[model samples]
Target: MTWVFLIGAILSETGGTLSLRMASKGGGRAWLLAVAAGFVAAFAFLTLALDGGMPLGVAYGIWAAAGVALTAITSRLLFHEPLTKVMALGIGLIIVGVLFIELGAAH
Candidate 1:
């Protein structure tokens, strides 16, 4: 389903972003390859989601917001990065905004 593809896109994008962080920290060729693959898979999955009837605005909004939030949380866990309360509040706002977008689209 579209939702399945959208979830796939979100996860893949998050993976790509995390891989980028790892590569930046001298993870080298393997991590770079992972980054490329993750991003490629992400776009492919996103295309599938759109093809499967998800609206462009809604799909992209969810994908971008979820990817950002997931990447930030995962980075905090894996790399001991700072995720301050203010950043958390911003992520929450992004989710809330996406919800509003989706709700508005239904009308």
Candidate 2:
């Protein structure tokens, strides 16, 4: 199903982003390879989602926003980074925005 592909794209993209962070900390040949591979896999899965009937604008928009949100959360959890009130509010706004976009696309 298209939804499945979309979910895959979301996960892959998020993985790729996290891998970038890892690459940043790694700073060596293995990490460099990971960064390259992550990006390649991310785009590959994204293309499959798009081909499976997800509109480019909607799919990309949601993917980007969700990826950002999840990545932020993951970083906070893993790195003991501050999850301030303002950051939480911003994430809430992003969720609302995604809902609006999805609803608008439906009409």
Highest lDDT: which candidate?
A: 1
lDDT of 2 by residue, 41-85 (tens): 777777887888888888888888887888889889876778899
Clashing pairs in 1: none
Clash number for candidate 1: 0
What TM-score should be assigned to candidate 2?
0.88
Candidate 1: 10-residue stretch with minimal lDDT: 65-74
Tell me how many clashing residue pairs each candidate has.
0, 0
Alpha-carbon TM-score of each model against the true structure: 0.96, 0.88
Decoy 1 TM-score against native: 0.96
* lDDT (Cα) of model 1: 0.93
Candidate 1 regions with alpha-carbon error over 4 angstroms: none
Query: What's model 1's lDDT at 64?
Result: 94
- Candidate 1 RMSD to the real structure: 0.8
